[model samples]
Target: MRQKMLLAFAAGAMLASCGESENAEGPEVADLLFSGGTVYTVDGDATVAEAIAVRGDKILYVGSAEGAKAYVGPNTLTEDISGKIVFPGFTDSHAHLPDGGDTILGLGLGGLTSAEQIVHAVKAYADAHPELPAIMGSGWELNLFPDANPNKALLDEIVPDRPVMLVAADGHNGWVNTRALDLAGVTSETADPVNGRIERDAEGNPTGTLRESAQGLVSHIFPKPAVEDVVRNLEAGLAYQAGNGITATIDAAIMHDHNEAAYLEVSSRQDLPQRVRLSLLAAEEMVTSMVTPDNVEAVVEKLVERRAQFRAQAKDRLDADAVKIFVDGVPENHTAAMLEPYVNAPLGPDHRGEINLSEEALNAYAIALENAGFQIHIHAIGDRAVRVSLNALEGAIETNGERPRRHHLSHLEIVQPEDIQRFAPLGVTANLQALWHFNDAYISELTEPFLQEKLHRWIYPAKSFVNAGARVVWGSDWPVSTSDPFDSMEVAVLRKNPDDANDQSWIPEERLSVDDMIKALTINGAYLMGQEDIRGSLEVGKQADFILVDADPYKVLPEDISDIRVLRTYIGGRQVFSAAE
Candidate 1:
């Protein structure tokens, strides 16, 4: 009779009980229950809960610790997370996961300070890997070199026999040896591609440096990684992100067809540690040649077919609902399009940088993508690039009407005040790389002179965007920057590099609050990925994706936030990463 009563109560409450008879029915007993921690829901109210119960992959309960006890039963695993802070699993809105993984597995050149160091490292790597067909690596910063430009002469002196190409930290430029240039048939007569530049000497000879689209000349000839290698690298990258409390990420640029196939294979095997959304590269020609009205339709058709193919292949875990377009290059290289002339242009004062796509082409492409039900993710770093992207989005809206999907504008380094106000009204997301908010070597030494008086004011405007009611999401742009969300959060909040004692806030007014930063990393990111309703916060019906940290970021000093490490990360109620393990 007691068992019957208990079963009735459970059924009435819609709670599942473990070890119940086959005849018994209820909602199955929670497989796991986490209690005694400060649970940050990050919901609309930013509510705090004391306990949460999970059944299968969904949260079954979230309320008082005592109330959670009712759902506990045999076969249930309960953890007492006393003194720990629990948060919704972080989501990286922008990242190159596969490429970052490849960097880790290959020659990691992320932090070398000089050209000499790069040469030594490259030589050591080359000597160790004589079997490689072509040498390729990334992560060289322009500020470390004299004149902020790396020439072929340095590379030729070290590895003149073989082709070698090293990418800049930002991935916007490529530095190669003379052999690489020669192998790609890039010569002084090679007319500058539509949106790319081949740096040349005074005598019109190729200098072995390529910017933007021109990098494709050498990159296309480079041997592609095997499918197994790509899968291995992607797994490594996903593990790194999970260890840092990231539960989801978007591969900002899915470049090759092989990359898409690898991603589909991984998702099929359920080996992916975190949720992944892929943004297929739509403007490949713009990167190598140019986007013209003549080829715009062909490009759109290709993107549409690719999207359908990927979606049909991996219908469950894969999301190919977005397309990536590189509107302009980086500011440090003076390639990012701008409204006003650059203060220190290599060509002349009249040079305001170059736009990768014409206005008509951009408009047509954006409209076509939107009409096909794809979210547009544009890379716009400069003020003029941002404005042009906005104009394209506006045209798309005028053509197709407003859609449910919120488009994104990433790497917002130089948004004008007028453009800042346009974000909310246009329903566009400000996908910001908050890690670059501080005065880093790139900003101080390489880019400052070019901006002149607009230095601080033109940087990331996080606070201003939020105040204007724009939806803001944060990303690391990993491989270009650190993938740790806490590191980015600290920089976002303090507006200064946490590692540099001498550094001051670059733009004090742009600093975000702890609450705002948390939301940006969690809920806002989920919204950007179109998964807000499923896993953004700790709700009764949402997916059980959350993490346990060593300390509460809200209670710690702003500067100490980055020191608060993630002890465990959970995705779909499964412990995928643990610091103890």
Candidate 2:
């Protein structure tokens, strides 16, 4: 009985024309009624609803044709979507929107094969902005270079007169010309900072490349862009997110600078199409602005007060529940702390991943913050860093009893199987970006020699994590890779390198199904952010946040999934972005 009825209703919901027959007398009135499509409501039991009726911003009804009709009115418009698919709006769990936007507008040297090509691209930009003091570019690939490392020598050839600095693709390193180095006062005599390294050539000469905090040395000397420029970059990023059906994103890093202030203004004005979860970053010394040693309790109180102000102003547009902490940088180029020595670096055998803070310091800070009811989004890319974070998290919880707040390991790019189980116990979410599997070919090669037994393991272990009952959400890590959720979904399922077929993909068994992939991009992401109760899936009372695609995902082959186009995107029942209209 009830089971049969549910199955029949689900069948009707899967078909586009079934709803029409239910109301054959006339069209049922609805502000918007989408019928006849594969609608994936990634809610409990993974319900497949037939028709979704929207009245204003929230879902009026979501069920079979019979259930949807009760909410219809005389002026409602019904859409026949027989050849389409509807899923909750995607969420990018971690990305640098402004950086990505600026990169898109700047010189594109993401995959240049050699430093010479990068110099040429910079020269082309210089030709137009001849009066500009120095050239600033980003997105350089070390793997693409013949020497597998870039230095200032390459930049000197093309622009010896002008100071030039190019940030590495990972955002952890920089390559500067000799002129830029001299202007910044970084020389062979400059000692490497605690959390950074200055790469050098033979005879103790400073090479053009600076890793981690060392890059900050050269960047501080450059003139900063205007607030209008930051706003423009943010607008570009917002448009990009809307085009890709991304409804929200967690910015990986937010510094206490004028650019951030301008971003908040833009966000409060709703100029940003996508919702932002801003996480402020600060050093231990800088924490005094919001906290003090004598009145640490008062500082926590102020942090909350400030967050409330931002939330009230931005309304549903901003979430200020977390603060970011950079645990360590990337493992490539020997900046990312590793438990073992680099497989192919000049460094000795006893090298380990860098720790920006002592274990005690990290544990104490996290505990204090958690007790104050603020979430901590830790940036940990390497396995050693993950271990340190896990240890710190454990210590923090021990000091302060477990609370309902969420903790995240922002780029869990390399997790051991054993760590997967710990995530659920530790209340940590794996914020993974699957698109890296498509764009980055060096990850596997660089990791193989280090983890010999677990060589070439897939970074986003979707199946294993799901099996372990661990929550896994997808992210774009944009600016580092393309910010297309469809592209990311396509890569996660197919496990095929679209960029280079010759590059073999690993752990095919770890790939997720289309159904699971949709959930990770939608409800799972919402769940991680504590927004699942109001948004995420399509259901009665849930916000009408979804996108309509041209082709039905169920009918298309996995490889052809990326061919599906987003025709329209709706947020809170409003047509925020429409491609056709």
Candidate 3:
């Protein structure tokens, strides 16, 4: 679904086989037929077929090209896709959609390669929008700067008169100019808020970098993106997901953050491009204050009722059944709840970071929510947060007894070895962003030095989780990173940047096979979305959600995986994207 035309397949073998099948016996006439190429079903046994027939939105046939001919009729739309590599339409388990959409509409910084370009871009954007009180945008990398720290001075060089606020590509940190910081009244004297930091210099002067929750200090001053703009942007975001071959996703933080309005707007038009799962944000206070043993059932009852009510209005495309909870912050800011003190504890020597909720509160909410039938999508980045979440899941099982649930923990950034095995037995999914598994310049400059050797080594154990029998799934966490599925697939298999051949595999031992990575992106992610049965694989009865790639990933070089192009994307047998178009 990515945007790019690739007539890369051999001109001879490429499309020679997309003709009607010779077998003419079956009564089931296919509405559409694709023949003479490899079709990776990603089914239970991982069936690979030479042809596929679609009748309406469901797959009508998948078998040898000759066998598929039986399902073809006079009116069937057939394609000779012999040269293409077919795959299931992808699913992004964790993405901030409306926000991802909004970033694209902002200063448009994602494609810029240098800091100088960013400074000029900001200045140009500021000059053009003088009526705006402040400028805000995202998509800047951290490794481009010294110590992964971006000072406000760069923006000051261009727009010293206006306030400029921009976030890092990861969305975990923020950089602002002095005018913006001053408008927020954030100075050396301003104390770091809970679960955040205001990076300072040797003299304790604000360095213009805000980590985690500290971004909020400057956020309040910027004009909110109008509701209409947000809706259009969100609609654009869903199309972007489709462009990346993503047909489904859990918009990680939706309704609770006021994204529901935009989602409802899209649904009302019946223009939703993908199957979206609305993971309503559960405020930290919801667990810390609202849920207790005395009122746990009552709070859960109300939450379930609200979810049912929202679902009734959201239409079939957007489902509201999951709750997103943040257990801790990211490792880059030292706000991630670690089991032990950091190697360089700038906050304090004894500080080991803290969780957003108490153990008792998390336990109560998880149990009640599970019993009430809500999918819990937990953001557990630090080791302690991972452990705390596992404990909560364990308590949920002990209380309600193990049952079917798509409950998952996203961003298992650091999972202790002892707790790694707990996911599978607990039926918990390891919702991973493998794109961040590499040991990059940012890690060397900012994160590695701050983590204990053992903890640092435990980063992104995708293989360990897979080996531990845990249900492994992949998520883009877009706006934080690129949503290109192949990029993450390459990282999961190589554990390094696919573009840099010289880069060492960060942890070669933990690398997964290509097949495992594919399953994680396809079936596993669908499992997390609670649509595996109907949407994940290309089974006969399943919805025809699949993609066609220009080259076979299995036949390509390990590092060249990301370069493979998605030629087309289909959902429910309906073509959603075509690179050639």
Candidate No. with top TM-score: 1
- List per-prediction Cα lDDT, in the order shown: 0.81, 0.71, 0.79
Task: Kindly indicate the candidate among 2 and 3 with the higher lDDT.
Answer: 3
TM-score computed on alpha carbons, candidate 2 = 0.88
lDDT of 1: 0.81
Q: Residue 257 error for model 1, in Å?
A: 3.2
- In candidate 2, what are the lDDT values of residues 1-581, reduced to their tens digit? 00110101221233222222224675445699987766777666566767788877777766676666665777888877874778888888888777777887876577677656877888889888888888888888867653445777778877888888887777777788999889888888999876777888887778888877777778877778787887787778877887888887887666656546666677566435677787766643111122224554554565666567677667577767777778777756665656655555566666656767666667766777798677888888767778888888888888777578678887766667787788888878777777765435466445454443453473556677777777778878787777777777767876667555454545787776666667778988888778999888877778888888887555566556666788888888877688873
Q: Write the per-residue lDDT of candidate 1 for residues 1-581, one digit (tens) a residue.
A: 00110101111112122111111564456899888887888766556777888888888887677777877889899999986988999999899887788889997789787778989999999989999878899988788876566889988887888899898888888899989988889888899876778888899988877888888888777887889888888888899899989999988988646677678767665545788888888655323324577887777778778777766666454678888988888888788888888787687889888777788888888888887888889999889999999999988888887568689999998889989999999999999898888888777776777875764586778899999899999888998888888888888987887887557777899988777788888999999988999988888778889999988777776777778889999998889899972
Write down the TM-score for model 1: 0.93
Predicted candidate 3 versus true structure: per-residue lDDT over 1-581, tens digit per residue:
22222222221222112323233553478999888788877776666778888888888787778877778779998888867878888999989888788778767677677788888888888888988777888888877777667888888887888788898877778899999988889988899876577889999988889887788788778776667888878877888898898989888875444466667666644446788888766543211123445666766776676687666677666787887778887776677889998887667777777787678878998987887778998989889999999899888888898688778999988889989988988889999888888987657777788888977778888899889998888899997888998888778878886667678889788887777778888998888887888978887778888888887877676677788778888888888887873
What's the CA RMSD of model 1 in angstroms? 7.6
Residue pairs clashing, model 2: 13-50, 16-36, 29-73, 30-76, 330-336, 337-353, 337-354, 338-353
On lDDT, the stronger of 1 and 3 is: 1
Q: Best to worst by lDDT, what's the order?
A: 1, 3, 2
Which wins on TM-score, candidate 2 or candidate 3? 3
Candidate 1 has which clashing residue pairs, if any? 16-28, 16-29, 213-287
List the candidate 2 regions with Cα displacement exceeding 4 Å: 1-29, 65-74, 111-116, 270-272, 284-309, 438-440, 449-460, 501-504
